[model samples]
Target: MTLAVPPTVPDPSVRSAIERLRQEFPELGPAPIVLVVRTCREELRGSPDGALPELVERLARQRLRVSLD
Candidate 1:
């Protein structure tokens, strides 16, 4: 599951992730799928500015099947 971006900066990559999941789980049908994105304050260790986009880009760099189509 991919994290939903903040209102100010939407992430287009999420749609690819959703499409990936759908292909893997065709039985899902039209039911709603929800996966909340969360990172504990401690885990962040006071992340730098623009952390969300940074993290998202870093994740994309890993070549996660989030999109290789």
Candidate 2:
């Protein structure tokens, strides 16, 4: 028997949100994945290719909220 793994589908909401953010802030490069789960408030994951401080500030300004565990 072969076990099939389901393909990952990108969330529409997250894509839309990222698009909007990009439109607003083009300097942010690319928006990290933002997950809004029921249990948690909001989570931002993935690393941006750039300076750590700049990335942090950019994400903050874009309002991409995230919580670490």
Largest TM-score belongs to which candidate? 2
Q: Candidate 1 — worst ten consecutive residues by lDDT sum?
A: 33-42
lDDT score, candidate 1: 0.37
Q: What is the C-alpha lDDT of each candidate?
A: 0.37, 0.37
Regions more than 4 Å wrong, model 1? 1-10, 34-69
Candidate 1 lDDT over residue span 1-69, tens digit each: 334333344444434444544555455432322132121212333566456444533443333333333
> Candidate 2: lDDT over CA atoms?
0.37
Backbone clashes for every candidate come to 0, 0
| Per-residue C-alpha lDDT of model 2 across residues 1-69, encoded as one tens digit per residue | 122232266444344445555565555466232222100112223443334334434444434433221
**Candidate no. 1 TM-score:** 0.32
40 Cα displacement, candidate 1 (Å):
13
Give me the runs in candidate 2 sitting further than 4 Å from their true place.
1-7, 31-69
